[model samples]
Target: MTLKSFSGVALAALAVTFLSAASAQANDISKCVLSGEKGSVAITPVNEGAITVETALPNPAWWNGDTPDQIADGYEYCLAANIAHRAGFDKVNLVVSSFPALIANANQNKDLAMATISITDERKKVLSFSAPYFSSDIGVMVKAGTKVDAETVKTFRIGVLQGTTGAKFVSERIKPAEEKVYAENPAMFAALMAGQIDAAITDTAIILGQAAKSNGALTVAAQYQTGEFYGAIYPKESPNKEAMDKIIDDMRADGTLAKLASTYLADSWGADPTKVPYLKP
Candidate 1:
């Protein structure tokens, strides 16, 4: 072949190769995203190259409810899936585990934990956290007919999930007259209904969900803007921290995060957290 023709052909081949690689990367991220409702996992191998993502599914409304027998579903779970996909994971193994174990695994550099983990000064010592993706300003849930407010919060019997920011808020800020600790939301909320406690303090999402499901039997009374944002847990120096934070930041910049939260989590949150009414700490 003529030298000029050979050079042109070679350049065309290289161009094709580069385009192919870029296309594959784009394809990877697109297919890696959540299998939104009306989309079928059986048809689209969105998770073909899935990476393990651990989370403690607190409830259907709080976390994704996907089981081995079902598809990935939930607010935080979908949020994690979106961020993971953007970070270049095709799919998430979406393992259900405990919060403590999830944190331990992150400490061990095992898997990415995307549960609704509140960032705190103490946890920052051992774990790297992505930029805040959710807020955990303390919120209150009172039985539907039980009226209360920030000023009188101290007099009511309060239930809070142990070891949570809500528990801390009550213990340190409000110092309720009577307080009870439960292991999880169900237990804490059950106490409220059983009259074991007159109210519950927790993150807005949990309290909103519980109140909604209570069918007017419970309602949110107060929201405290604690400046606590949810951060995904990572190993102390894992590289994923920066990448995950970038993706979350981009989502926020592009209004993607707001849209996701509104669609999947607003019911549980009751309002846009960024603009919602909150109690002064």
Candidate 2:
């Protein structure tokens, strides 16, 4: 019969059928199918048979441990392991490198780098990034009991990591009285503890991790919803980007990403980042 002549129940059944078809279309695997074997997508190795994934050290909740070999536990580390398995690599050569250095060289020294590197239009020029794996918002931190809000944040002396979106936010939005840029997280947090800067701005999860380990010396005073997403960086010329993106998208579509976040970051990050109070900037 004609669709316009259908009864209410018939219309409902037709609607459900249409929705099911749409869902199936959205999850079509053909879009992300691997070019090589199902698991062993051919990838140029940085070290023999291993897929070398570089990440900066001392990244707290995202990457703990002093060295790559001794990596105890963290969300990003777990992600690296999963990537290796899906790519059919028996070994994962985890290496250390700063975010700025990796981005500058476009991971020339490794197969890929997952240093909680955010995906941005500007960075896409120098690096090929996989589908986003994590989302983050900008956060403002201060020594405990040192009060500051969205309005007052602009007046404080701010500390930021060089070449980070947080640093860019501080300069363009906060316009704080003074800005101190550090090449790394440790140095910037140290400056905050020493009273060198009145506030620090960066990813909410990062600041929260620092505050949790600070023993009452620091607190995440404010945050802004910058709607940032982190992506794994592949070399500009790498042919494996498509396959890697498929793998990451699969992980995200499944419950793998959520499980990893709970296993590595639930306790350390405390409250949900989105639930944190948002500052109107």
Candidate 3:
């Protein structure tokens, strides 16, 4: 072949190889965005606790009703699924283990834990946390007309979601004589309605949502300034931890987080992104 023709052909081959490499890189990112191709992420409830996750349901059309599946489709589950999908995971799996089990599994397997875990300095020592997805304060829910002040409510049988910061707060701060920890918030609320528990302590947003749906059956006794910051928990040494943090930060900057919060937390919960408090490290 002529020397000029040979040179042209070699250049073309080089160009093709470069293009192929670029395309492959782009595909990897796309796969990460679509299927979280690294692996399947598992999120379980808090240790013995039953608070629903923001990612419980991939869709919100079926959030009413008293079934586990229905509750799963409610706000927390849906929110988690939405964020997972947006962050490039093909499918985010929600596991139904207790909160403690979830934490233990994450520690062992290094999977992401998405149950509504509140970020605390003590927990940060054990695991990594994503940016605050939701901000909540501790609140008390009692039967309508229950004559109890916030101080007296601490002495009564206080129901809490098992393995939650609320439960921990009650244990360390309130130290109630009889504390009932349920696997799920709905169960705790049910116990209050049944008179099995005097009052339920939980995130103000969840309790307010429950109260709004209950038609005056329950009332908020008092809302405390516990300053709870709910976050997506991950194993302490997760490789994807930085990536997940970047995605959450990007979402916050781009207003996606605010939009999701508004959809799930309701207007009354005050979904303003600017108003959301960040957890101090």
Among the numbered candidates, top lDDT falls to 2
Model 3: CA > 4 A from native: 1-82, 85-90, 106-111, 267-281
Question: For model 3, what is the error of residue 206's alpha carbon versus the real structure, in angstroms, after optimal superposition?
Answer: 2.2
Q: Rate the local accuracy (lDDT) of all candidates.
A: 0.61, 0.71, 0.54
TM-score of each: 0.75, 0.83, 0.65
Ten-residue region with minimum lDDT total, candidate 1 = 36-45
Question: After TM-score superposition, what is the CA distance of residue 77 in candidate 1 from its true location, in Å?
Answer: 1.6
Count of steric clashes across candidates, in order = 3, 0, 23
Q: Can you write out model 1's per-residue Cα lDDT over 1-281, one digit (the tens) per residue? A: 33334222221122222112322223233222232221112121223445456676566564644352354555566666666555445555666666556656533433467767788897777777777765566678887766676677889898987667778788898888898988767788888889999888887766776676677888787788766677777655564556566666665544445544555566554544434356665
Residues 37-97, candidate 3: write the lDDT tens digits.
Answer: 2222333323321222323211222133343343533344444444455444434344555
Task: Tell me the TM-score of model 1.
Answer: 0.75
RMSD per candidate (Å) reads 13.3, 10.0, 15.7
Error of 1 at 101 (Å): 4.1
Runs off by more than 4 Å, candidate 1: 1-48, 66-71, 100-110, 268-277
Best model number under TM-score: 2
